[model samples]
Target: MSFKINFDSENVSTGEFQLVAEGKYEASIINAEAKEWQGQFSIGFDVEIRSDVEQKHQGAKVLYNTLYLSSTNPEYAENTEKKRNSFLVACGYSGKQSLDLDEVVKNIIGKSVLVYIKHVEDKNDKERKYPRVSFVAESKVNPPQPSGPPITVGSDDLPF
Candidate 1:
């Protein structure tokens, strides 16, 4: 099917992408997906910076982290596990209970965390830089509390 369409190219504008500032910011896990690369299993996280933190940025989204589930090297494997554990703990995983990676990842969606971002120069192109989530932890900021109507007592209700 073909139809006539009206379009204007002059009004369209493109802006250069900006990397999130290198600092700690409150962010939420917008997506969690299982991914495999070169026979290695991993989970990729897409984190969005809270808009309230900075007005100009308007909540920039970034590829936060990729946690590998398996690695052939012993040291790398141990480090990977530690990273996963740290992420789980930051998302409210208690060590007192049994752990499940799939469930933990699912439950962590929408969870708030303090992410420390750092800019790294691209290996191939030094002029190009990217934001990397160097570290993350439980957010110190508390969730908003509910407010209710003020309680009032009538004069008649009070007993002498």
Candidate 2:
């Protein structure tokens, strides 16, 4: 008889972190699919966490979410729109007009963004804290902003 932990501990995460910790992480949209539920269709996003945040998320691939359209259900118009708008905005959408599933997927999939995480506890007895996305911004490809006072020098300073 033997007892052993076979996996690499360094590759795993406990998923314990402070609430509302702002972190810049890269993510890849793994998949998009539509599902019908309660007589309505919703586009579900499967995103894969990437870069540094992967450790914080315990190597988790995605934070799952579903986008609902107002046209999907008249009774849930408000709720649907809210979900749809928030999801789109989080995916770096800035357009006023709503887009179809294919368009949304095209815009989000394979794209990375900066996100702020918030911890919220459930109403249940345990009240476990769950990390939720509070803010999202388009990933900056260029180098970081320059720091220090502005220089107003003549063109003669140039090497060219």
TM-score of each: 0.69, 0.46
Off by over 4 Å in 1: 1-14, 53-58, 96-98, 144-160
What tens-digit string does per-residue lDDT give for candidate 2 at 1-160?
9898779867977887544333554555667676677777777765555544434653355355555554644787876677667666757778677467667666676656554555556768456765555444555452234469887888898888
RMSD, one per candidate, in order: 10.2, 11.9
Candidate 2 residues lying further than 4 Å off, grouped into runs, are 1-26, 52-55, 71-76, 114-160
Local distance difference test, each candidate: 0.76, 0.59
What's the lDDT for residue 105 in model 1?
71
CA lDDT for candidate 1:
0.76
lDDT of candidate 1 over 1-160, digit per residue (tens): 9999889999676887667789887888888877777888777887888765543355788784776767888868887777767777778887677766578679888888877788989999999999888767787775334369777899988996
lDDT of 1 at 104: 64
Clashing pairs in 1: none
